[model samples]
Target: MTVVTPVAARVTEGRSLTWRVSLSEAADADMSTMFVVVPATAPGLSTKDVPARWPRDTAGAKPDPERPLSKVDGLYLFVDVPAGRTSADVTLPTLGDRVAEPAEPVRFRQTDMDTGEPLPDGLVLSGSVLDAS
Candidate 1:
């Protein structure tokens, strides 16, 4: 199973939010991609904005540059996970000056990089809420 949690309970304006992605076990060859979906109505949030930092490997060697997070369709962020890794940290940029406090929680999904098919038991709901000040 895959789980995502916010690194901080509250964030400030113009600052990025960090999320920790944890897998119950190491990823297999088929499970290579993970997607984090945020609400589209989030204030001051845009998919075009680049993440403040690169994803950091938490349970292995340095993060794979080829596996950096990329925004998709202006709604979700996806990253390629190295096989045998259990956890990683991803930082997303929050632009503009307006406060962003979405009512809905963030969601997570894992899929095969090549086939683009979701893995069994890959969809997780309500991972965390983004609370920006």
Candidate 2:
């Protein structure tokens, strides 16, 4: 099981996150896991590494208040599933390692976060859609 930072009623963009991720087996079937700090926030990096710095207004329209203004920076891990690429289990410390809010699932057929293009072959993971929270 994963402990995700529950999405807030009004989570703002540019907010920072802390997180850690591992396999369910690593938890020994128990979800009481501790958090490892996110590496991107550590020293020796330039401003380019910041997630909050990702462009938000490039679409020529104000961002939907519910959408992320930048690439969300959070703690995450990839778990090996059978015969496929790793699936990301993201952990957000800003919200206590809870998953994105609204807890809604989305398919990649939805609009792209970047150019608003229809995501080709879209999101295959639970995180593809974020909650309205």
Candidate 3:
């Protein structure tokens, strides 16, 4: 199982997330091939929007990486936010299907990228979705 630890929330263009991800259950799984579930409305804030100073090799820094963003069924985004380097622009693209009324505040679910299934444990991170529009 994978656990998500949301560190902080900030607003740049939209909701930005600084979180730590790890595997709670050790398995022959690829960390790179994982997905984080996010609100469908915030795809723009993925790794594509982080500033240069972000994710520096500092003491508090997590192993963050620039990941590709894609929509899943239009209700949520299967985001590829890597673990460790702890910073990401949590904005999502407004494409495809959408929830009529998304629940608040924001939340994340760790899942297998290949199977699109949850990590088979209580791996969740729930927090506010700061909107700096």
Candidate 4:
């Protein structure tokens, strides 16, 4: 899994901001699941943390993105689904629903749903506005 990018900013003032974050397979083929993580080489990698579940609707926001951890907005990790495959499934390794923004570097990893093999390239760590509530 990849971290995409570490967010650096103070918590929003006044009202809280809602952030809709997504971490999915960025490859052309369908991936069973994706991971958001700080690379082992990254300074503050936490093996106990779990990535946030990505929303399926890639075109628009279905559920509002705002949440308590919305401060770490603009960071996304993704992969594309392969042909003949149209579904994504992932097993969360920890209890945390969303990973906290790391104080150091990180990356997202796409893996097979069954085999757990790393998906081919096309992964990225980008700072793009996803959607907001």
Among these predictions, the greatest TM-score belongs to: 1
Model 3, runs deviating above 4 Å = 1-3, 9-15, 22-30, 36-103, 131-133
Model 1 CA lDDT for position 11: 49
Tens digits of per-residue lDDT, candidate 3, 59-87, equal 12222453422222212333343444332
Whole-model lDDT for model 3 versus the true structure? 0.40
Show the lowest summed lDDT stretch of 10 residues, model 1: 59-68
Shift in Å, residue 81, candidate 1: 2.5
Best by lDDT: 1
Error of 4 at 33 (Å): 3.1
In model 2, which regions exceed 4 Å deviation? 1-61, 64-101, 109-125, 128-133
Q: How does residue 33 of candidate 2 score in lDDT?
A: 21
* TM-score of every candidate relative to the true structure: 0.46, 0.19, 0.38, 0.28
Model 3 root mean square deviation, Cα atoms: 11.5
lDDT of 1 by residue, 1-97 (tens): 6776777424443455566777798888534455544332333233222233323322122223322122332233465456888877665554433
Candidate 4 residue 101 C-alpha distance from true site, Å = 13
The ten-residue window of minimal lDDT in model 2 covers 36-45
Q: Which ten residues in a row have the lowest lDDT in candidate 3?
A: 54-63
In the range 1-133, model 4's lDDT, one tens digit per residue, is 3233333211212211122223443545444344433243434322222233432222222223442222232222334345454433322221222433433223444445454444576343312111111
Query: lDDT of each structure?
Result: 0.45, 0.27, 0.40, 0.31
lDDT of 4 at 119: 57
On lDDT, the stronger of 1 and 3 is 1
